[model samples]
Target: MTQPQGALLVGSIAFDDAERTMRTAATELGGLLRRIPDGEVGPRFHWIMFQPDVLGQAEGIERVGEERIPLRMLDARPLRVADGVDPREIRFPELGYARAARESYALFRRLREEGVIAPGMRFQVSLPTPLAVVGAFFPPEQRAAIEPAYREAMSREVEEILAAVPHEDLAVQWDLAVEFQIIEELPGGVAAWWDGAWAGVVERAAWGVDLVPHDVEVGLHLCYGDVAEKHFVEPRDAGNLVRFANAIADAARRVPAWVHLPVPIERDDDAFFSPLADLRLPEETELYLGLVHREDGAEGAQRRIAAAQRVVPRFGVATECGIGRAPAGTTEGILRTHAEVAAPW
Candidate 1:
């Protein structure tokens, strides 16, 4: 196994989402948060953005239909909208995701070229899945209809990104939160949706790999949610973990990708590491462990990393989830501390 000289984060970046919230205040807060977490650190850092708006722009597409997509939590009958309504008339916000990718790449290149990072450093870019992108922007009714087109567009955007960034120096993380849910509800009905809709992302992302010049790190990250403790995180058992891990392993076979999971923050170490202790990883893939807790400080981060090292070797470190919703000062401190610990020996 190849040990990372420094950290490659799969968590939140400092940038605020323009479509979701006003950037000015959030950016300020995010900046402040980064400073403390950073600990004026080691092991160069690459702040990753989970920006779907960037993905949307890269594709050159839009959702042009009117429909209220039913949420898993909502009443299906009442939420359903009339069919045949032209979606073009609805004022869906235009998210310039492609432009964002272009700019993001430019900024990274500038940082690398301008002596901001020492030679032999790496930067990682992470984009959320199509389901996440659509769920955040379009109404529930429009999600299924809008997702297919958006995914096709996402592939194009990723290609353009590969053209600009140094493949070996870059890593792409595909965030899939659906895997956890697919298990518990599989024997029920959610598996049908997973089969029909959720599965396409794995293939599309793998296809995105072909667009690259080769040697670029492409990873798949599966999580429960952004921040909220909803249906997915509620007291999972060993059986649930086994199912999720099995499904993920299946996906890994088809795609040349790394798999990531949060450490056992909520569960005991025995419960968390026992099953995975002997699991075989793909020859070229990595098993990224999300080692830092969201609310943990420097001490907490240190303790978590030590505990993680005790159980899992040759693992990548990451946050419990995206820190987009977290204040800047806190996230920065966490990130910086992580980079320092992950620095080469």
Candidate 2:
């Protein structure tokens, strides 16, 4: 059976012990990762949600849930704005990528020297799009106002990571789940974050990528939102992902190292992948289809890979989103499926 040439991890592997996490991934999937994440070991359960709540201060911000709830909220009060908050001062809290990446990179170095990790792999740092954070918690009217400050803060985190990690050994991925809302027109519920067409979205999207230096690899993880392990809206096809990725490629000053698009588990048909034939990415920019699912493992990945090959002659493999929120004890099987379905790098 044919398989992709390489593989990619879209950040957040599932493990509580940081050292154990690095060792496991480096041992099992070293050949697949061009970069490695810290297993998101701490409080990043939903990836980027918890980090931003502490970035900029909102005077009236209050949590709606008392203890625990599936959906957390900031009590969307209409006519309310984050006006008192200085967006310029927004900074992601303690688990910032700079410190986190450094720690993971040190462990990765040790593992590589011990011959557990593949040589020359960089540390992969994943970040949420500013709009993803703004749209999720901020009021609609304030999202635009709040985005600039938050975007800059994210850049600061990236700058710190670059400063701490070697450029030759670093790769950055922008977690772009919310951008799909604009592409899908936010069918089930109107999202407060996006109000512009594809062009404006592209312009904003370019801002995120441009922050990374040319030498460091930059990639975009285009997603349909993974909340409680379900999409905000399952894609009917890959059309919107293709459209959005092309727009970003044209708009950004530099080409991305790769572009990753999700494949809903049920979408192993030609229709779901045919839009990839229209993808106009630069040759150096790799395409990674998120086709590996924990549910059916290698067999499911193979079916999706077969369908994708008809349109995309070359590509890599990943899950629809990070496996951080996946069921416990399923991580190794999912990791193995990626390696099993794709040719090792």
- For every model shown, what is its TM-score relative to the native structure? 0.64, 0.89
> Model 1, range 1-345, lDDT digits (tens) per residue?
233233435545444432112122123222211111111011111121223223323323343334533332221121111255443323223233344545555554555476544344444556655555555445555656655655665666677667766666566666666444443443332232334443554454444444444476666666665544123454253344434444545554344356666654554445555566555556656656665565655456556555555555666566655555455556557556555455442
Model 2 score (lDDT): 0.78
For residues 88-174, what per-residue lDDT tens digits would candidate 2 score against the true structure?
Answer: 544434436567777877887787798777778777788887777767666666677667756776777788888888899888899
The most accurate candidate by lDDT is 2
Model 1 TM-score on a 0 to 1 scale? 0.64
